[model samples]
Target: MRLELEKRPERSKIMAVVSPIAAVVATLLTGAVIFAAIGIPPLKGLWVFFLEPFSSLWSIEELVVKATPLILIGIGLSIAYRANVWNIGAEGQLTAGALAGSLVPIFANSWQSPLTLVAMLALGVLGGMLWGLIPALLKIKSGANEILVSLMLVYVAQLLLDWLVRGPWRDPHGYNFPKSVSFDGWQTMPTIGDGRLNWGILFALVAAVALAVLLRRTMKGFEIRVLGEAPRAGRFAGFSSDRMVVFAFLVSGGLAGLAGVIELTSTVGQLQPNISPGYGFTAIIVAFLGRLDPIGVIVAALMLAVSYLGGEAAQVALGLSDKAARVFQGVLLFWVLACDTLILYRLRFVPGLPAGETAR
Candidate 1:
């Protein structure tokens, strides 16, 4: 027998809506099996992976802290994905932003003003946009594959960050650690309480609302949607592909950059060799899981944040490795893509034909 996948003339909107939910359920079920394989009770492991993060106010606060960057980067990725502009280098752009934003803070640490924080954020955005522009411009002018270009740049950015933190930017008196000097009190982000939660959460929320408005209520938003769906139609309607590409890259890169700076200044408070724990890549899943909507991205980001917390909780509670949590995320992504694929195509089963061409 053979199996085939045939595309549908029209996709089911209901299936589109239900696919993500179904994927989540599938992930939970698969996770249960994985836990049971490791000699742990499936229910208890699931609880630790999904529910334990919400058991306390402190954990909830940590969830917000983790979700902050995810939401910020996810929103930016949604913009790019909506316009069909493949920007797989949000990680690179984020690193670029962190490097640029920390320029003044690290090199000119003596300077302190009310505007120091603002300036760093602005620099970060500029850096991210510039980094984003490279692949966009390459794709526009040279017909290069943006997916490849963007992904390659991620390694370059990571190497650059490693070099800086381990070399010139390394703290002078920090026992030879590969990290920049910590931000001073004035440079730190304001916190809501005595915890690590900072004002960045408010920024992410406002950005989400703003992006929702832009996507739903503006002409640019319409252009992005149309261009993504049908480029010929977009061109016929007087939209410029080049313009959309640039705009998408700029907006996406800018947001990612801002997110990098906020994460650094608010959470880490110093430039380091590894400033991000895959926030850029994780945001891609967030963007897709959230259905490319800003509000949805926020919800998706929270879910992922919970996954991280749950992963740690599982490690402490059941002696599972950190890789177990990453496995859960991978499974979730696999199921999501699988569901999306089935949404657009149906399986066709057939019995096997004769082994030889006897008739011919």
Candidate 2:
């Protein structure tokens, strides 16, 4: 006998919506097992990691602070994904943006001004867009694979930042440290309170709303969606593939660059060797976990931010290695992908007494 089931198209869409939630639950359950294996009380460990971060106003503020960059990058990635463009170089673009934005402050050697702030922000956007354009141009002109080119550029961007901070952009009075000079209050983003939270949260929220509207309520968005789902259909409707690629990459890279600027201005208050901590890469997970929807990305970004706070707490309270937290993050991504696959495919079983005599 063989076991088989008919495929359901509508069921797949419904599962896609629930896959992320299932992944979260699976991660928690799997984590509990790990905690027990590590000689910690599973319940207490889970509570400390997941609940402790929200038990105070301060921690809540920190969550917002960390989530801001993720949201910005996730939103940008959602747009690119919707247009069927893959921009894996957001990390590099982000670094380039921060590097370009910091140029004014590093060279000026004076108090911050409105002009400086605007110029830096604009330059940051330009830096990211230019970096994004490299892959787009290659893909269009030479049939190059953007996924490979974009990802390869990330290392280049990191190296560029390392060289600048360790060389020309290094602070003069910081005793040979590899970091940039600090920004003045005017150059830095204004804080919401005495906490780490800043105006970057508002920027992320606004961008999310704007993208949601643009994608759901505009003809341009329709073109993007069509192009993503069916390139032939889009071409028939007069949409240019090259234009979509450039537009998607520019928007995604520009937003990632803006996120880099915000992180520098609001959180770190200056350029550093590792300002991002992989926020650009994390945003890719955020975009997928949120189902590539604008509103979904916001929620997923917040959830991922909580995971970061949870990691810190686990490190401090549980005496766990910092790398332990990364394991949880990796598990989340793995299970999430697995859930998505299950949603699209199913398992089947067969039983037989013999290969030559297969009759029931």
Candidate 3:
């Protein structure tokens, strides 16, 4: 007997809603097993890894802070993926945005006004769009795979950031560290109340709502969905694939760049060799888990943020490594993809032909 997958006549609507939930449950079970294997009590470890993050107000605030970047980037990615454009270099775009945005504060240290912040945010989005445009142009002109081109650019951006912070952008007064000067006054993001929570969360929420409207209530959204589902049909309907590709990349890259700037101005307060904890990469999983919906991304981003807090909690409470967050994220993505597969295909055992006999 041989096993084969048979495609469904139509996608399963029930499974569409259930897959993410099922993935979460499977990941939890797997986490329990992993904890036990590592000689920790399963239940205790689970609590430390999941529930402990919500046990305090401060931790809850941190969750919002972490989720801010994920939501912004994930919303952008959802647009790109929905349009059938694969952009794997959001991380690079984010780095480029950060560098571009920082030029304002780095060079205009004497300028401390609201205009500085405005310029920084605008340049950040522009930088991301410019970086994203490269892969789109290459795909259009040379038929290059966007996946490979975009992913490779990530390393280039990282290296560039490292060089700048370590060489030119390095703070001269701060003893010799690989970081730019601290942002001050209007160069930094405004905060809410007395907490570390900043206006970035508002940006994330606004982006999510705006994109949700765009995807549900706009003709452009129809074009993206049509092109993604059937390229030939889209072409017949007068849709331009090249334009959609550029639009998708620009939207996603711009958001990622905005995210990078928000992280810098709100959280990091300066340019550095590393401004993100894999938020660009993690947003890919967020986009998938949310079923490529902007509104759904908000909830998905929060769940992933919990994993970040959980990892830190586990490190202090259960004596686990901080790498636990990555493991959790990996397992969650694996299960999510597996569950999504079952929504589109069914597995069956088929009887094999006897001795390779030719039958007509």
- Candidate topping lDDT: 3
Off by over 4 Å in 1: 1-11, 341-360
Best by TM-score: 3
Error of 2 at 359 (Å): 14
> Candidate 2 — number of clashing residue pairs?
0
lDDT of each: 0.89, 0.87, 0.93
Clashes of 1: 0
Q: Which ten residues in a row are the worst by lDDT in model 1?
A: 351-360
**lDDT, candidate 2, 1-360, per-residue tens:** 665444556448778878999999999999899999999999998998888989999999999999998998999999999899999889988988888788778887585677777787788888888888999999999989999999999999999999989998888987899888888866788888888888889989999999999999999899989999999999999999999999999989998888888888888888778988788988998898888888999999988898889989998999987677678878888888888875766646667554456664
For candidate 2, the lDDT comes to: 0.87
TM-score of each: 0.92, 0.92, 0.95
Tell me the spans in candidate 2 whose CA falls farther than 4 Å from its real position.
1-6, 11-13, 342-360
Tens digits of per-residue lDDT, candidate 3, 1-360, equal 776788999998988999999999999999999999999999999999999989998999999999999999999999999989999899999998999999999898989889999999999999899999999999998999999999999999999999999999899987898989999899999998788889999999999999999998999988989999999999999999999999999999999999999999999999888899999999999999999999989999999999999999999998899998999999999999999987898878878854345364
Q: What is the C-alpha RMSD of each candidate to the true structure, in Å?
A: 2.7, 2.8, 2.2
Better of 1 and 3 by TM-score: 3
Which runs of model 3 end up more than 4 angstroms from their true locations? Answer: 1-6, 346-360
- Scored against the true structure, residue 115 in model 3 reaches a CA lDDT of 96
Alpha-carbon deviation at 90 in model 3, angstroms: 0.9
